[model samples]
Target: MSAQQRRGEPPPLPEPLSPLIDAHTHLDACGARDADDVRVLLDRAGAAGVQAVVTIADDLDAARWAADAATWDPRVYAAVALHPTRADALTDDARAELERLAAGPRVVAVGETGMDLYWPGRLDGCAEPSAQRESFAWHIDLAKRTGKPLMIHNRDADAEVLDVLRAEGAPETVIFHCFSSGPEMARTCVDAGWVLSLSGTVSFKNARDLREAATLIPPGQLLVETDAPFLTPHPYRGAPNEPYCLPYTVRALADVVDRPAELLAEQSSDTARRVYGL
Candidate 1:
């Protein structure tokens, strides 16, 4: 059994009121290693109305896995990047390999890469802001060169993330993956035509600001992601997250915007397809 199952698996929520795409998740981290394993996971997600997904990478090996996983099922796609937290890992050899993978079939976005100040101060394997800035810039350039959407991972470094984006000239498609900021940041992003991809955090009682941000997002600018194997939605916050758990977050978001879950799902799924060209 996977660790998630061992940790007390919660059955996938009832089928979503409408079909939705899990814009970001990690099949490898969820212990899905082969085509058969991926099929089982996709089967569960399909049963819950998550008809498609974009599994994201945080490092070279993960990127390689993501590219291959995308081929395992037509329902699956991939995004490749060295995560902000692991920015320092983008070595010369790694970059070339990543470039090769980014251009590979079914690799849609060039991210989950941005800045994170939440890690310990520039030591003990934690990347310093300088290294992260350099890496973020590289990823930005790569996204532009590849003509792929840039999926950003901002954590406690919103200002810096914006600064680099502005300097680099935001990509035609920019995604604030797992948006954890407040109204001010939300407005800035929306005004710039950047997409806000909300995770399960919006369902947390303490995330009043994030919930409010959701309401302000325009229909086409909104997207949903599970960030699975982490950030599981409320009522099961600590349970190992997976694409199948996406319905819970969608329902919570619908409540936040006071719209039917099906409507929100359709809108977000449409935007997801446009952004990722699914």
Candidate 2:
């Protein structure tokens, strides 16, 4: 059995100290495959004090599903993009369809897109880094054209990703989703007026760099996410993650920044709304 199964179902966290938003997640990946699945998951989140969540899609089929999923539930919004590793899928035909889905109602951001060097030599059959870089630039342009926030997914390619953003001149709103860099990177992003969206990984006991980065972002530039079905927070590190698991990360971030949990939630939610225009 998986660790999560051996441990049994994950339990609910205490109700959030204030309203919060999950800046990124993938409802489809979380086993919320349809409206009913989405509702069941979202209801759990609502009861836990999460007011909204953005379901991000990393491929064309999932992008279509994500755009539709956003409309299926009132509290769920969407962000559509080709994940960097899947950059090879961004053919002319895919690009056309992505543009259409990006403009779909309730699609709030353009991302989970950026360079990810974690899988060199086609790990998991990923496209090469050159292809990933090409795709990242195209997505950046789409964000500008769509007038949506650009949500980036940087993995072991911080310098390269940031360089592309600088070279291409970023869209008006840029956010580094699931930020995994250090305090220096955090300061650099904030200096560039980009938002840093923290994920459950921040709660890991060994995440000292992440903790220090948390201290660098101003409240206005800070946001949080679950990156569900992955990066499940500590104390439940191996548990199945869903939107309801967000409070753990929020509480963790609140502690690291030495801010009141409620105030942090309030501000982070506000930042999410402004960044995504939700």
Instruction: State the lDDT of candidate 1 residue by residue for 163-251, as single tens digits.
Output: 99889888899999999899999999999999999999998989999998888899889999999989989878777788998989999
Where model 1 places Cα greater than 4 Å from the true spot, the runs are 1-7
Q: Encode model 2's per-residue lDDT on 46-99: one tens digit a residue.
A: 888998999999999889999999999999999999999899999999999999
Task: Report lDDT per candidate.
Answer: 0.90, 0.90
Compute the lDDT for candidate 2.
0.90
- Give the TM-score (vs. native) of candidate 1: 0.95
Clash counts for all predictions: 0, 0
